[model samples]
Target: MIKNFKWLLLVSLSFVACNNDDNTTVVEEPVSSGTASFTKYVALGDSFAAGYSDGALFKKGQEGSYVNIVAQQFATAGGGDFKIPFTSDNFGGLLLGGNVIAGVRLYFNGAGPAPVSGTPTTEVSTKITGPFNNLGIPGAKSYHLVAPGYGNVAGVASGKANPYFARFATSSGTTVLADALVQAPTFFSLWIGGNDVLGYATSGGVGVNQTGNLDPATYGGNDITDPNVFASVYSSLVTNLTANGAKGVVANLPYVNTLPYFTTVPYNPVPLTAEVAAQLNAGYAAYNGGLQYAAANGLITAAEATKRTVKFVAGSNAVVVVDSYLTNLAAYGIPSYRQATAEDLPVLTSRTFIGTLVNGNPAAVNGVSVPLADQWILTKDEIAEVKVATDAYNVTIKAIADAKGLAFVDTKVIMTQLSSGGIVSNSFTLTSAYVTGGAFSLDGIHPSPRGYALIANAFTAAINAKYSSTLKPVDLSQYSILYPAIIQ
Candidate 1:
């Protein structure tokens, strides 16, 4: 009887195992190309599209770029080999005639961002052959894309050509648009125009705002491109890209002021004791007295004098800065020196130089005693200039995208979200806070690897929505927030 019972139990167990196997059969949703084609995909843009992170472009960074991420997803549908003009080594930067033209990549050093110890190996003069797909060049503005000889190796030393593009450009005279056209891409992506105003913002508004200047040749490297010029160049680029019936995606510029490079350093970062504060106040007593004299003499109003007063408190105090916008009393020997305010934005590089002693003198501090230069801070007026140009460029981008019926990504909204409360993706919450934020890279200007993943998802969603494609979004957990100092 016991043997019979054992046999029956074994049979029941086998029956349960068979049922479980049948129930556990998994099925995946088939990927579809939909109305779009990925037969020949080409990407054109600036550093962000090139996957530049930690202040430089390297092998890993290029691999993690949003353009590569989108192309990877497209592979499941009909995407072919997406080639990238890769650098020689993971240590970024560039070499021209065996000399370092650009600096190496930055990595976290347990405290903050620091450049890796090594020389770059990628030689700009050593050209790579291409009908390459990824045509994103670092430091490319809207007009640079359509400019001839933009990749000429000889022009690199003269600042007339981009070294990144020079590495892979087909011919010295071939335009970025012409190269893309030669490939005859079935699909494309364009995210240019960030560098248009980025240089001005990053330089703390030292660059001019050439809003009415129609000639790009006359524009400085740090100058903001005129909105009309951006619009004209953008329209031309799109017209050529879609001339042969190629579908593409385009992104608008974000307010560069919101980036960590401009927002990381606080305007008031000086902490002083009572004695120290008193000493500093005494040192500025003459300047304060001069301001009062100017007001009483009718050279300036009481309010204007008060606004220009340089005072320090016992605890935390704002740094003194030279504001060019202030009334010039230079003829009377009163400089435009004033204490920084909340409205002022300090550049990231200012953090290291703020409290340091100048010439090793205890009384001569950079931010306190020696006022910071205009290049170290962006005044409220300068911020407004950047906003106006950015707003104008975005408007032009949106109108062009609508008229061309292309996929559009509003990166301005994305950046605003990052600055405000952060965005939730999958199980992670990404913010714009530096280092720990997990969004921006060590450079504070570019996005981290995970940040690039977020951007890729944004681009893919736009593409899927516009083209009716079923491309899958990448899992954010796969990408890292920061690159380690030693890459193994």
Candidate 2:
């Protein structure tokens, strides 16, 4: 009986050891202090800081956000708990589905108006139990960061009442982000302000006209931000972030136009039917001729207007021109500077607008040709506007980071290399489309899982250099950054 008891005891011990081994996942954390000193960290930023992607906040993504991932690395190195938002699988990432995205897609349940994405059920009061980490609001801007209770659940904290961050916020109490900041963080990572520009560009780059005219598109004017205000608010936000004794890392904005959504879109209006094209072409040319003559007479600067062009679509024996420009070119007395109206362009001209073939390959344009994705190259004026604004924002960011003693992650410089196709690393390479490994998400603005990992590495490197800390760089091998799109 003694011998038998010993045998059972030995088996029980072995089982416990096996379970322990499975649970043990040791990872080296990155250094946060100068040359390696910080043992604690708190991350704060906007959407990029949060793991909100694919129009939904899934469990994998929310936990996998760079902030949380880096926190995990820290925990493995004896850092403390790395608390982040979590949601069950099969739940969406953000509230709205990712159809507007340039690459993200969803599994079909074979239903129309398919499920729109949804925010997580775990609100602030619930998920955040202890001293928290990773407080990134999805739609936060430089100025909005301090809006009291702006993004919180209907009640918890004032910082939790944001419309943009609403999808990720909880109704439990105060905002998860604002409360985390009040804890007096030791280390943080901040990357905000992308939405300041992205939101404007994505919304068709038009502003609503108070006139309440025929169509919203026609009435809207250009409400792009004034360059000066952008810098001032950015500085204010950055300065405040540092005032709390938090050693943080700051990132600059990426080129808003570089994303495939912006680059791979059409510029000209749609082509008209063969017979219709001829009739419109006559009126359109006559109208354009008059504008050109009038403009030369000091009536308008030719620089202000797009040169008229008649498009020849593939498989269509027709030439379509815009009478819209000519028709209202002289109606220039409106609030909008004599720029051509949406009415003047083809029916659909938005760079990011998508149309289903309902006939040909899913990627077809206007139900006909395989639309060339790289149609709307940024015009010189647009490039000038982007660069000038970007430079101003970067200057402010660098200054604040230096003052606050945080690392500066130069995302602007990093993204300049996103051209054609190239390998980002040995294990993962870049594909042109949404195939798994493609660096960009469907929206083109955000990065794919692989791409975000790349961002994490860059940030780690920055922290290492600035703080003299010896944080471990992540092994991105296990992660899947590419999309696998099986075109039907």
Pick the lDDT winner: 1
User: Which digits, one per residue and each the tens of the lDDT, describe model 2 over residues 1-488?
Assistant: 99999999999999999988999877745444444334557676776777765444455666667777677655644566666655434344322232221112332333311333433343333233344466676655555555555544443222224433443443324444555556666666778767655544543333332212112232112234455666776666556556766577789877765555555433443544666546544634544565567567676577533443332433332212222223344355421112122222111124324334536654344312322221222333444455566677777788777776778998876676654454466466664343233666554556666667777878878977887766676776765663222211
Cα-based RMSD of the predictions, in order? 4.5, 11.4
Tell me the deviation in Å of residue 230 in model 2: 4.4
User: For model 1, how does the per-residue alpha-carbon lDDT over 289-400 read when each residue is reduced to its tens digit?
Assistant: 9999999999999998999999898888999999988888999999999999999999999999998998899889998999998889998888898899999999988998
- How many times do residue backbones clash in model 2? 47
Candidate 1 clashing pairs, residues 3+ apart or interchain: none
Model 1 gets an lDDT of 0.90
What's the TM-score of each model vs. the native?
0.93, 0.67
Taken over the whole model, the C-alpha lDDT of each candidate is 0.90, 0.52
Candidate 2 segments exceeding 4 Å error: 1-37, 93-131, 152-160, 163-178, 208-233, 236-240, 266-280, 292-298, 301-306, 309-383, 420-423, 431-437, 482-488
